[model samples]
Target: MTERNTDLEARTEAKPLPRVSPATDILEREDGFYVYMDIPGVRREDLKIDINENEMVVTGRAGQAASEKETFLEVQFGPGEYIRAVSLSDLVDREHIKASLKDGVLTIHLPRLEKASPRRIPVQSA
Candidate 1:
């Protein structure tokens, strides 16, 4: 019998992940700004909301991992992550930003800072 020696090498390639952009609507009013986004299939546990001094970021993933192998006749949705970033100014109060997710829609409330709101000037007799 003869002895043999073998060696194996492994290689890896870097790839970029896909990102999805959800439908969003921005409304501006005298009191504040309202942001509504449509993110179907996303769950509360998979959602993330980040508020910065000058920006807001939202990211989430839709659907759950399959327990077993399955087949699909029609597939309209794919496994991906939803990401969106919005720019903000000093007029918005970052501390008061609130968000809620319901019925596959994400709502964000951005209240205007007091100094940013319009005030009526009072006149006085000299």
Candidate 2:
């Protein structure tokens, strides 16, 4: 049954959101995690970020040439979309996620939630 549930989850994630798999780096620290993605030619205005539960979806569109119906000497433009998705673990604090984009690179910071511990009680020695 657990295997079936895992399969179902995989299928659900594969249903939508065509992923481009942009170059990315993930840095893990004691308190949090940082994600850096390189999306060249992508503009800041066309970037999108969506977070749901443990899933984070990012999509960005690169800028296009101003001229229309113009022939390019070299066809170097690939798909304009830059898409990536990440599944976070339970420790991540979803509400405190922060993101920024600069120089065609996007960075996201995910803070981890503090673990609960048993309260210490003081006792007087008889």
Candidate 3:
């Protein structure tokens, strides 16, 4: 086989490949920001969320087979790594961030830093 053919074969044989298309939502509030992601067929233990500085990373793996007799008909979504990185304008308090997954919907609450929150300053006449 030619080099191109070999590369194609390798690509076809690779398992657990990422699809790269995922639905996400980011909402900003007065107090903080909320990130919502839809990840179907993913278990709680299979999901991973990481936050570093101003970047947030979400990753998960979907199982390929539920049983030996079952097979995928339309395999757009498959057993693969799902990764997404988002940058935040507001400083986030990593220590207080909360995450929860329910019914394939992952919701993450990123609280803004204490110093980053908006404060009202008293005005004085000069």
Candidate 4:
């Protein structure tokens, strides 16, 4: 019985934590694109954003605030990690990308590349 309990505890400790994807919204304009994500209970310091090649990844950890001395009578929500990955197109300018988080909402701006932006060509007379 002791060996069985030890094995179970080891397995549980080795298991990876589940990940949840935050709700996101992507919008496109003539000049740029906007991305909004809802990540409740995640602090700014716990969030990470990375861009490599044509992919952008967003990650955040929503940690529980209870201390070691605190005891819960009824447990509901627990700690969780949030992750989201976005694919970038050739038209987007990766150098000028920007992001901001406010009130649990993360907003990312991806501007269109200068060469890919629509422009009116002037007509030439012979």
Candidate 5:
């Protein structure tokens, strides 16, 4: 097993907001592609996904509440907007994309266009 190195300490030491530097994985299959990202402390309503001509953008924002009294902080994570942009190939079908978030994980499914997908053609003899 491989040990994972996360920047939790650095983030929490900086500020008191949710850090948004999520990691992502991209997988390509014969039919389509899948993109998985780890976005913690983000709700469904706080996420915004957009697909432009050749780019896919994911943006999230978490607001910070004002403290009522003096408080001692043990750790802090700067809270601000999280934005990530990815460029997609033309093979993807922009109209048939799907996204879902659960358990702090966001998954996006991009199906290849019918014209771009590989098809086995039958040979005919005249």
Candidate 6:
């Protein structure tokens, strides 16, 4: 009988991770904008955000969090990557943008530029 190469067999059996888009919501306020995204199974260390040329990119790697000792019989959500991009407007102040992740929820704050904010002009009676 011929011996088989287990390393090569494992490599061929490996499947590529899936790519998914997380549910997102954007809310505009008088002072700025708030973005909320639902990205479950993603860890803080595996998340990345980048801003360039009026575009904001968000990416995260999500996978099963169970320990190796725990074996899954039926799998619904497998390993995957979450990606989303937003086109920023000129009114946004990119320098002051902030983001946070809590309980599988990502929140982003995009503050508007001072000059771009609305102001009330005083009415003078002539």
Across 1-126, the per-residue lDDT of candidate 3 in tens digits comes to 255444433444564465654599999887798999988878999998877777888988766544544433433444556788988666888888899999988999888999987789999999
Q: Judging by TM-score against the true structure, name the best candidate.
A: 6
Model 1 lDDT per residue over 1-126, tens place: 011111000101132334789999999977699999998878999999987768899998875343323434444455567999999888999888889999999999999998878888999999
Residue 98 deviation, candidate 6, in Å?
0.5
Task: Specify the highest-lDDT model's number.
Answer: 4
What is the per-residue lDDT of model 2 for residues 21-84, given as tens digits with 9 covering 90 to 100? 7999999876699999998777788899998877999989765543543434444344357888
Q: Model 5 clash pairs?
A: 12-76, 17-77, 17-79
lDDT values, one for every candidate: 0.76, 0.75, 0.75, 0.83, 0.74, 0.82
Which stretches of model 5 miss by more than 4 angstroms?
1-20, 64-72, 120-126
Candidate 6, lDDT over the whole model: 0.82
TM-score-superior candidate, 1 or 3: 1
Off by over 4 Å in 2: 1-19, 116-126
Question: How big is the RMSD of model 2?
Answer: 12.4
TM-score of each: 0.76, 0.68, 0.75, 0.76, 0.70, 0.79
Q: RMSD to the native, candidate 6?
A: 5.7
lDDT of 4 by residue, 1-126 (tens): 556444444433565444889899999976699999998889999999999999999999887565644445555555668999999999999889999999989999999999987889999998
- Residue range with the least summed lDDT across 10 consecutive positions in model 2: 70-79
Flag regions of model 4 displaced more than 4 Å: 1-15, 67-76, 122-126
Candidate 1 contains a number of clashing pairs equal to 0
- What lDDT tens digits, residue by residue, belong to model 6 across residues 11-98? 2247655678999999998779999999998899999999999899999988756564444455556667899998899999999999
